[model samples]
Target: MLKKLEAQPHPDDANPLLRLTNLDVTFTTSTGTVTAVREANLTIYPGQTVAIVGESGSGKSTTAAAIIGLLPGTGKVTSGSIEFDGADITHLSPKEWVAIRGSGIGMVPQDPMTNLNPVWRIGTQVKEALKANNVVPKSEIGQRVADVLEEAGLPDAERRAKQYPHEFSGGMRQRALIGIGMAANPKLLIADEPTSALDVTVQRRILDHLQVLTEEKGTAVLFITHDLGLAAERAEQLVVMHRGRVVESGPALEILQHPQHPYTKRLVSAAPSLASQRIEVAHEKGIAVTDEELTGSGAGSVSTSEIIRVENLVKEFDVRGAKGEAKILRAVDDVSFGVRSGTTLALVGESGSGKSTVANMVLNLIDPTSGKVFFKGEDLSTLNSKDLFKMRRKLQVVFQNPYGSLDPMYSIFRVVEEPLRVHNIGSKKERVNKVVDLLDRVALPRSVMRRYPNELSGGQRQRVAIARALALDPEVVVLDEAVSALDVLVQNQILLLLNDLQADLGLTYLFITHDLAVVRLIADDVVVMEKGKIVEAAPSDQLFDDPQKEYTRELIDAVPGRKIQLAL
Candidate 1:
């Protein structure tokens, strides 16, 4: 039996800083009225840190949006009262919301790409927030921006301030968003999946700064995320939401140790932390992995023969700098690796580490400046345009953002069948049948075939993308950050599906991601990259158990839930 973590005592008589009573939120959609949150009740004390965790479409984000009065797509609170600091502000006007938007309630939205305006410079955006809130004097705004950026772990803050969103990497953009969200030092901070795109080391730094908000500034934090293990480690209290209702709420660790709700139990079991623990124990016991231990697949028996080999791969691009001077930017330099047949080779690194650049080269999406790429011992450079087009059918790719990758104009049936249509392989009826089978393989229902990309959730969109990738019956698949945007449970499902597919079809995978925990769950070999160089390359067990490089060790230690052992 797992021991329960002792819950910290709270002052029962103290007034709550924020309280939601019988909160019912609904959205007016084309189909009909949809209830997002039903009779929800929650309370947060001043300076307290609480987490709301669940899979996508579970209403955690919806609840956070409601608190800030920024709910999307005609969502409104009905027959509910929201009291903040003893003030009933449930139905605040737009002008009224402006007064509390920054100074009283700060929000760090998910997806830095869409959150930050691309045309504006980093400092300009931060200064706009500070000026709007009147948090500092006009003369002191510049220095304040630097201070917040530095606090968010951006080095050389002055130089970085002038850079636009496009110039910054994914991690750097997230840091900028954090700096903007924390500029006014609001009373309450709502961080919605802020660090989901960041690597472990950067994630640790951002999380540490959030801890400072509660400890030093007496600011309460309402964290919304899909990683249950992360919520268990960071927050004092936890609320698990399933299908828009709170299924369980209690002390964070207590919920993990002894979850009463079936959904909560499923979440606890599906966490990558528990999977890593199982891998660690198996390695400690010197137990050879069996087929059952490897997600009902032959993932454990991946052969050692090379399927795709990259040698001295170098890619460079010409860029015009601030002064209109041409500069050669080396994206991938002298990097080399090989993916074994019927196995997963994970390329692990932070943003701008050239992981995606390498994947692009392997897929022949871009021509390399130098070096050689061999697909099944045949040089990619040697193939003509006709042969290259034919060879591409044997190689497929699933990208990070499925919504962006899939065309919105196309329905689920069109999206999955387009590849088949382009290949000229099947009749109209045959292609329709193939689309249904592919959707079934990815666990999507037949009814979804009529829906557009916007009609489905994030996980569902990713499944459609996977189904499309497998439509051509490719020999190799490149999954680039494929499951990073998903919650833990969805990520586990996708990883398991990939494993089963690899086992059944003997497919090869080139997995690229920043998450080391997920890499441990599904990867056969790991290649650690930094600044367009291979820092370390080893088997999954060796990389996790006995990493030889200091950078690798730092990344492993920075995993969010590494401190606590999950119950198996």
Candidate 2:
């Protein structure tokens, strides 16, 4: 609602590059119809960064798709006008859109793997992308491709361009995707969750490139993501969406630093990577949580009743070099920790620290060459398949991307019923009843029972996934980056839900994450991990009050916006 009034025209649009007037996107289903975008009006200037922020179901990406004429087959822009520099381009046929998609507008899809042809060479694909937009003469295509790759900040651009997509790591793949997007230098770039899959360092590098390009070429950006921190770091303008509607829209700083909306406030409070800085500050000032504050803040009711314990856990992996011999990469080396019943033990670390490996071993998904995992004082490794299956119900997990974890083909009902069906623990009637009850507990409607994963938003899918994980009534829930991919507001809601569930169900948590902000909010005890080893372990209060390890201090220092004095 804010930007609609006073924002200046973007420098790149040349002349009001594109505009969406009273846009309405809808879909017609077999049983009924749904409106995905409601009177969504927008005016994007060339060379400006317009951040579309929202929870999973916020209709942000759908709006981007509509602008690009890439809506799903079942969906349609029933009533709206999409004008490119004053030309009404809303209803263009697919063939007509083909000419415009790459030349006039480019899209960097959310998942790099989804857009790229895994089998093709990266250079060849990039060359094709450039050629499709008629960027250069056929003779100069190869050189042009090299330039684009270098501009994208890839190492050994020429050599990397020759490699296949699979050869690139997650960060590299995203950069390669950016290379393709920049190939033709389209007037507008629609980046759907471009940085969601990247580490912070990589994310910062990529955003730097995007900023330079915008300033140099005046390319307007429509960045779609669930990360509010990222949106603040990059975009000048902001648009917040929820339940397929815009709840707030304004300058990025105003919305992020001084949000008036309740939803927006919650999102800011829940940003784990950012909010976790509270713990570091305490350590810096050597301030301990007082008895009254600890009790009031949730530490008073907690006790050290170890449900899971790891003693001198060691995990290693083999890597091969040109010599054709293997080198051991110690992923989890001599790590040790304990989880108390009805409390969370947070694992905080950087990428490649063996946090996930530790989680997998605890889940018994992977075998540890050495070390012992004691569950309820029993050796986990000694359990038989039958007993292991039973043990699984006592410990469950929630992954990073809820959408990817859930099957797109199955309805919410079937997805939630999976644990019951797998264990064959209940009758058909009993399972159905449980499914309905779990859905209600997760705050999802019964109407979603027949709805598929694709039909739900990011937050809704996560809720559905949470319900599924809770189906077995597990005592210990392993949330592996569970709230990492969500927008600030939705992430906070889920965290609160986890807290409530812990109180109601008497649950224990082995929360593995790179997000320190989460450690401040939910962790009863904290484990600082590095390269698969526990560098520090203490009660949350003590750890935050006085962190002794240098690595712990570094992790505390790495959080973005922690030192920045923000208004809100």
**Most accurate candidate by TM-score:** 1
Please provide TM-scores, in order, for all candidate models, with all chains considered together: 0.91, 0.81
Clashing pairs in 2: 13-46, 47-220, 56-458, 267-488, 267-489, 276-517
* True-vs-predicted CA distance for residue 288, candidate 2, Å: 12
Cα lDDT of candidate 1 equals: 0.86
Per-residue C-alpha lDDT of model 1 across residues 1-568, encoded as one tens digit per residue: 1113344566878788899888889999899999999887888888788899998888999999999999898999986889998899899999999998888888899889999999999999999999999998999999998988888779999989999999888878888887888888888889998887788788787787667644677888899999886787788889999998998999887898789999998898788765665566667778665543454232444587898999999998887662344477788989999998888888999888899999999999999999999999999999999999899898999999977999999999999999998889899999999999999999999999999999998888999999999999999999999988788888778888888788778889999988887887788889999989899999887788899999999878777677665554
RMSD of each: 3.3, 5.0
- What's model 2's overall lDDT? 0.80
CA lDDT of each prediction against the hidden true structure: 0.86, 0.80
- Residue-level lDDT of model 2, residues 413-436, one tens digit each, is 999999999999789999999999
Number of backbone collisions per candidate: 0, 6
lDDT of 1 at 478: 98
- Candidate 2: which stretches are off by over 4 Å? 1-14, 31-34, 74-78, 86-88, 91-99, 257-302, 318-329, 382-393, 400-474, 485-489, 534-564
lDDT of 2 at 9: 48
